[model samples]
Target chain A: MNEQPVIRTQGLTRYFGAKPAVYDLNLEVPRGCVFAFLGRNGSGKTTTIRMLLGLLQPTRGEGSILGHDIRSLPPEARARIGYLTEEHQLYDWMRVKECGGFQSQFYPRWNEKIFRGVIGHFNLKPTARVKDLSRGERAGLCLGLTLAPEPELLVLDDPAMGLDPVAHRSLMESMVYLTRRSDRTIFFSSHQLADVERVADYIAILDRSVLRMCCSLETFRNSVQQVRLRFPGPPPPLPDIPGLLQAFRAEGELRLTCVHYGATTEKALRALAPAQMEMVPLSLEDAFISYLGERGEKSFILSETEAQP
Target chain B: MSFNITISTGLNMPIYKQITDQVWLAFVTGKLAVGDQLPTVRTLAEDLVVNPNTVARAYADLMRDGLIESRAGRGVFITRKRKVFTREEGWRRLEPLIDAAIGEAMTMDFTHQELREAFEKKLGQWKHVKGGN
Candidate 1:
């Protein structure tokens, strides 16, 4: 493992005019790990990626990519990074081969073999014009270009969007192959939690321009859990237990979502001694929903609660 | 050989079950053999951007099924030489999901033939890719 993080941000903030897009963000992406930047639509994920790639200037704070200061570094620093935006546009008139050839001129270390392999694997037709490719094929072409450059880091904004199952799986395999061989760091943003859960070693959940959670994938999984308890009538108030992050009630039942359910919260729940209690392990999607709810997003709710104990 | 696993969000099946099923398929098709090292839970989790616990749960399930084993100071590895899936067991494991998918397809105005054709096509593709012939 590389000792220095490939990407580091300290209080990184970006604003659109007066509206804050990303606020006081601090993150460390360890070298060679595929880090997932997760968020709902318009949750500062794109803004953060833009700032990190030097495509947009930050309003305040600092970030370093490959040890180069993002704000101070020229395009040369960005030249070492491969970034695929969500709305990636390709020239419609150019043949797939022409585009690949054109992109190769910008990077000195572009790998023709890998490019050919990926193109073949994705079954992309070099003779076909960019306009002729399907949405998923277009994304695969962009991925081919990105991977060919052999950059130290890859920043992908929803690479899986609009892809069929086979294409998505192929793209993911290419990413895995790249990371494993080159030890490249990948920072990808996606609304697809399942994809994120599949490829990312670390995760950062962003919501409403704020960093909701950031941790290693292991820690993130270990920390959160969904607990189910049925009450006779209205549920009692929850105890103010440390590590108990959030709680709410459902139909004659109380649900406690915890960050790290230790002995204290267990004892606290046991104190209630409901008719029946079950601890259901949560998936990443469930955890993401709970975290977002706690931040008052209002998209989903646990239920009406009596009060906090 | 390491295969990258991707799970579909819109699919009705649980993500862990998908992982387990894919890994088992890989093992059964000779794509992954005994002693082939599996990606670390963290690496696989990051690739999928899922919580590590979810992948760990899948790993634990695989271990329980005797498909993979964990080695101290190393990592998980494919253990089963060949998966033993009886017809009934396989159907029992997959029937509910297939039924749900078929129901969903029907609701989307897909004819029975269309649904069956799609399944056959996917099954053919899987065989072609995994057969390595």
Candidate 2:
């Protein structure tokens, strides 16, 4: 395994007019880890990715991708990265095989077998024109092109955007195949939390221009927990619990979402003297929603009365 | 052997832990036997559509627990040897399982006494089944 990070940035800031899109971002992506960049819409994920790939200029600070400066990444270094953006850009008039043929001309390391295998996996015909393919088929074509070269680092922006369930699974298998060698690193951003939960080893979340959380997938899942406390009556006022992401009441139970839930947090929770309490496990999506949800908002009414109609 | 492993993300456990538990269950239920070959980390990850490292961690845990062993070039295989744990280690491992069960029971409004009686009744049935076998 390589000792150096595949991608590193220091004070990477990008501004649009007067407003900041990404601010003072310092990130280090270790070698061979499947890093997922996550955020709500317009939260600087694409901006950060564009800056890393040198597609967009930054307002200030510096960064490097694959050991080359992002601002002046040479053709040779750029060729070693397989970039698949949301737009699956390909010539509309070209046939599938023609697309591969044209792309293969630029990279000396392009593998014909990899191209054919991925195409077959996606059930794409060699004669299919780029304009005739569906959105998912086009995505498959782009993935085949990007993967044929066997790039050292793959940067994907929302790879699962328009993919169906089966196509998404194929994409995941493609990723797993890439990392089989233990040296291929993938940096992708997606709104598909389920897929991200499955494939990502590390994750960096951009919360509205701020780098909110960056850690391993397990660490992220474990850190943000939901605790449900049931009282004999309506729930009491919640204590000033640190790291409290959200607090809500529903059906006489007070539920709290907290980050880095530990002993002191448990003690404070216990002091409320609730009739019952238990930590509710959250899936990655649930935790992500809670982590980003409004703080201190309460009330989720199941029904006005217990009597059934 | 026809191997089928399913992973559920909705569980209270992590993916790696779920894998280990399923393997453990398979071993105890005789679905997996000693010397039976297990899928390689890469194959299983691709099959499950999960990170290979997650499967690798589960395999590492199974090996640590003495339920499986990896042959240098061949692949991972189930082993007959089960680990002998010290008392403290045994308690450490069992504590979480006990805690979860009790927590569930408590949430369902069961008292400690009721849980104890239920456990005792279940144990008696298990003993009688073993005796009949």
Candidate 3:
């Protein structure tokens, strides 16, 4: 196992004219870990990824990928990292086999078996022209090309985007298979929380242009929790509790969404003298929604008739 | 041995815990027997479309519980030694579970006698299954 982090950045920032796309970002991705980069759309995920791979220049600060500086990563180092973007770019004029032949020339460690396996699993024919393949087929071909080199680090930007259910399952199977080896690392940005919960060991949440949290998946899930307190009538004013992300009322019960629901928070809630108190376990998707949603906003808006006592 | 072990991503429990629980259930239900070879971590992960580390963790937990053992160069296999808890250990594990059951029963308006009867019925059903096995 490599002791050093596969990727690292220090105050990496990017600006588009007057507006900052990504601001003062710091990240450290350890080797052999499937790191999920999660955020809302246009939350600087792409900008940050682009900067890390040296596709775009950072407005300030610097970063490294696999120990090579991002500003000047050499071709040899670049060949050891597989990058798959949302767009599965390939020459429309080339055949599937021709594409593989063209890609294999640049990498000395290309594995024909992996390429063929992924292609066959996706039911793609080598003779088929790139232009004739479906969207999912194109993604599979890109994935095959990416995995054929067996890169030590895989950086994917929404690999599941625009893929159908069947194609998404194939992508997941390929990723799970890759997890068999502990020497390789995958850093991906995705909106698919369910998939992230299953595969990711570590995660870094980017909110807007800033980094909100970076921790283990379990840690993050455990941190964000919902507590339900039932009152005899209407719930009393919520006590001032630290780490409270959101609080609202539903069915005359006060529901509190908190970052860390420890003993201190429990004691504070107990002081409210509710008739009953319960802790509700949240799925990863629910937790993510609560964590990112607007704080202290009512979950639903009731009309005049529905709002009657 | 072939058995179906399905997991729901929407559940609050972690994926590894779900895998371990299902494997144990398979053993108890006679779907898996002693010396039955379990799938490799990689194979199971692929089938389930989950991270291999989660499957590995499940295997590790099963091994720790004496329910399964890994042979050198071979895949994991079900072990003969089913964990038999001592009276104290059994109580320690079951106390909270019993408490929860009783609490729920009471909330649902079941009397003490009704709760005891339900418990005995469950025990009888379990015994019948074990006897057939």
* Predicted candidate 2 versus true structure: per-residue lDDT over A149-210, tens digit per residue: 99999999999888988887788888777888688899999887777778899888787787
Interface RMSD of each: 7.6, 2.2, 1.9
The segments of candidate 1 whose C-alpha lies over 4 angstroms from its true place after superposition are A74-76, A230-234, A241-252, A294-309, B1-133
The candidate scoring highest on TM-score is 2
* CA-lDDT, candidates in order: 0.77, 0.84, 0.84
**Model 2 chain B lDDT-worst window of ten:** B124-133
Q: Clashes in each model (backbone N, CA, C under 3 Å)?
A: 18, 0, 0
| Candidate 2 chain A, poorest ten consecutive residues by summed lDDT | A300-309
Give per-residue CA lDDT, model 2, range B4-54, as digits (tens). Answer: 788976556788988998887777666788899999998898888899999
Supply candidate 1's per-residue lDDT for B78. Answer: 86
lDDT of 3 by residue, A1-309 (tens): 548889999999999999999988878899999999988899999999999889999999989999999999999899989999878999999999899999999899999999999988788999999999999999999999999999999999899898899988888888888877788999999988888978998888788787776777777777778887877688888768866778878765898988766887888999999776776778887777777778723332211222221
* Candidate 1 lDDT tens digits, A73-106: 6676677788887876899999999989999998
Q: What ranges in model 3 sit over 4 Å off?
A: A230-236, A248-254, A273-277, A296-309, B80-96, B99-113, B128-133
Q: After superposition, how far is residue A25 of candidate 2 from its true place, in Å?
A: 1.5
Native-referenced DockQ of model 2: 0.49
> CA lDDT of A279 in candidate 1?
65
